[model samples]
Target: MSAPDAGGESTRDREPVLRVRGLRKAYGERLVLDDVDLDVHAGDVVCLIGSSGSGKSTLLRCLDLLEPVDDGTIHLDGVEITDPAVDERAVRRRIGMVFQAYNLFPHLTVLENCTLAPRHAHGVRRREARDRALGLLERFGLAGHADQHPDRLSGGQQQRAAVVRALCTRPELLLLDEITAALDPELVGEVLDIVRDLAAGGTTMVLATHEMSFAREVATTVCFLEGGRILEQGPPARMFSDPTHERTRSFLKRVLAP
Candidate 1:
């Protein structure tokens, strides 16, 4: 599939917070992402929709520098992050990622989990990290559970703590990989609510989600992927109601079937 124009005319003049071009990734002989291109401006909520194994999660991992790409150029704030000389650790400090599983340290308290990266990786003072962690926990309604371990909290609460942990770093970009995929149906809303609040507050985010209705409501831009490529992309209104590609239309029809 031909790559769609990145960000359309609305974002033409402004530099994107995240920019990707000619991105490709492969595992052995199987290519997971093929010539993918994307742009995410500051405060933009970009949703990636695709079938399993269509490379959504791998794409997120590449953006976070967790996976080394085979070929591509990825720029964060105009800096070429794909460069071999770039500091992966420093780049990671600017990008926060939350996985499907909470991935919270089992033995640590929620507050400890939230403060670890800041205190150790970012060199935040212990006291300041504690203050920032508590503040974010309070904002997300997880403050009261600060001392609890991951086992002591519900799935939703644990996920919220995970998000709060990411936010405590004040990352310029946030990547969420199927965050709701691990939650019970009844518990999904709580985690999505936190994401909604973040969107409202203008946090820059790129999320791969199966929650079609939520993506329609929350995404500034949506990209539909099939067979490891972005086949269509546009504002949610158009992408949802009228996609340019037949593959995208068919995929949406199947997923949004009533």
Candidate 2:
């Protein structure tokens, strides 16, 4: 089946930016992801939402090739990335990932942190990498903190820097795993704002987020997972306001409760 574009229109002619089928992952004896299927088009912002341990983070990790799936296929731009013969490192260059924790290097300056992968992995010249890194950092309101170490910045700044670092690779797909989950309540908005901008700028993204309101506001499609399965998925307005499944409705009631 063809994927839907960011506008939710079917785009069968153009290849999907990402595709997953029968994705299953297990840790020890526990199955973390079960028979998951998903497709993301060139400009879609697909948000995966559910309670903790519902496989949101694991799914994102699988997409980024960070976690090896026990069984499934992951195709990026029509190439099956899960094949053993595929170069995992090369595949990663085209896919970016950010975790809940700000995993910036403490010793590296923010600029250095941002340029490291582009310079080392992609072989981007030092000057070119620095230029692009600074541009993204400035665009995201972190220009002033470029030379500062991550420890010097607030949680929000560090996460924003992480996003910039990911963008430096110019990845075709970005996987964001609860990027705002670690911030203080007051600081969460700043990080969400960066994601909003990325969505607006047409960056194809799949993110696992617990922020229901943010998902409703920015998601091209909302997927509600339960016990590692996608129990329901649709446009955000329908998923939030008029969910067809009782499970979805019940989950929303608790999450959106005042």
Candidate 3:
């Protein structure tokens, strides 16, 4: 699909890989997401940034169909995935999610962790799945650790393995929710480097991240979400340097201050 240029000309000819409109989610009486809307085109690395409790993770969960929304529409490749009757497992196969915690199974080896989803969910043969998993692990510098259990790998290595696991399914879209939040400060860069590589290779993604510098550096589009609403969104050059919302400026000031 055609995408808009930097000048914001119409790219309506190209449909977005993912489109969300009028999204709303709540827990009990508290609304965590309020009418959120977003569009992510193919090859776009869209980053959602905000203070804690601002619904960044909730939005990602909603998109992944992990959390049901009270109201809204989410379309993946033009299919209405939010519909109750839609095949959740099938949708998940086309969209991979990597969470803050590594979420790797304790009993599974790194290679097994990467191969399980494709092998079981999609009926891929074990050999074919293992071959693809190894290639991803090798490319991401995790080949040596493939036979190790999750407990044996460092936080950065495990997270990288999680990413490799997600990619093994060949998802059309990837959802990353604060993938570095649980890592050591020194270990964070290694995980971020994997994301940078994915962005460079044209992998479509929508990520919620607290790493301001990484968002600024790797995002094709930056969105500042506040109290579950997107207050401002634009190219990183503009969103980071010249946000129009007062709330966005205040939040950035607190986070970006030296």
Candidate 4:
């Protein structure tokens, strides 16, 4: 990742853990993210809420450089990585992403899924990575299922393994794109509980979630994006209870309804 060639990254000598500005992406004529701006400091959980196709997931992908941005800059610890020419793997290594699907290897045991990334990305020894994997499994309440292949475990268990896999890489920032959204209603709670514990324990997270209640409980900051642009953003209390923008209020009402 190269340093930014322009201005407006507010991080000082300590460096902001993550910063994004004017992030834009599109496919032909369909604009996805229109100049999205966000900042995440150490140990903050920022929840992103939006309507379908609002580009929340795209924004997260762009941060990790999984998808090249059409315009804008993403800065991670003072490195300007928004340029399409930057080393994508270098950026991705610093930012871990947990996808909505439990993408664990069906044939691999829980322990294998957790240790794979660290061994491949960080070049960590298998013994060391396995040690860390075991610790994370225990932390996520899946230590007892270490030898079970993904198919043998419940969906909740598999998702937890995925989270542990991302954590094993020791990413400075974690992107959770609705990891529990695909689970059975009964199984969603277990995954959410693990994530709640992670946020409480000071993990830096950027979550795009439909779990508004869970977001309200765990997020330090909340953002509302609509049609590729952020409509509102503030502390959780303000964003939920006293949103200033009418569009934000309308969006929240529609999504947060019981």
Candidate 1 lDDT by residue in tens digits, 64-160: 9999999989999999999999999999999999999989999899999999999999999999999999999999999899999989999999999
Top of the candidates by lDDT: 1
Clashing pairs in 4: none
Clashes of each: 0, 0, 2, 0
Per residue, candidate 3 scores C-alpha lDDT tens digits across 88-143 of 98899899999999899989999999999999998999999999999999999999
What 10-residue stretch in candidate 1 is worst by lDDT?
3-12
The count of backbone overlaps in candidate 4 is 0
Which prediction has more favorable TM-score, 3 or 4?
3
Indicate the residue-level lDDT of 91 in model 2: 96
Q: Report RMSD (Å) for each prediction in the order shown.
A: 1.1, 2.6, 3.1, 4.6
Top candidate by TM-score? 1
What C-alpha lDDT values do all the predictions have? 0.93, 0.91, 0.92, 0.85
The CA lDDT at 143 in model 4 is 92
The better candidate by lDDT, 2 or 3, is 3
Deviation in angstroms for 244 in model 4?
Answer: 0.8
lDDT for model 1 comes to 0.93
Residue 206 alpha-carbon offset, candidate 4, angstroms: 0.2
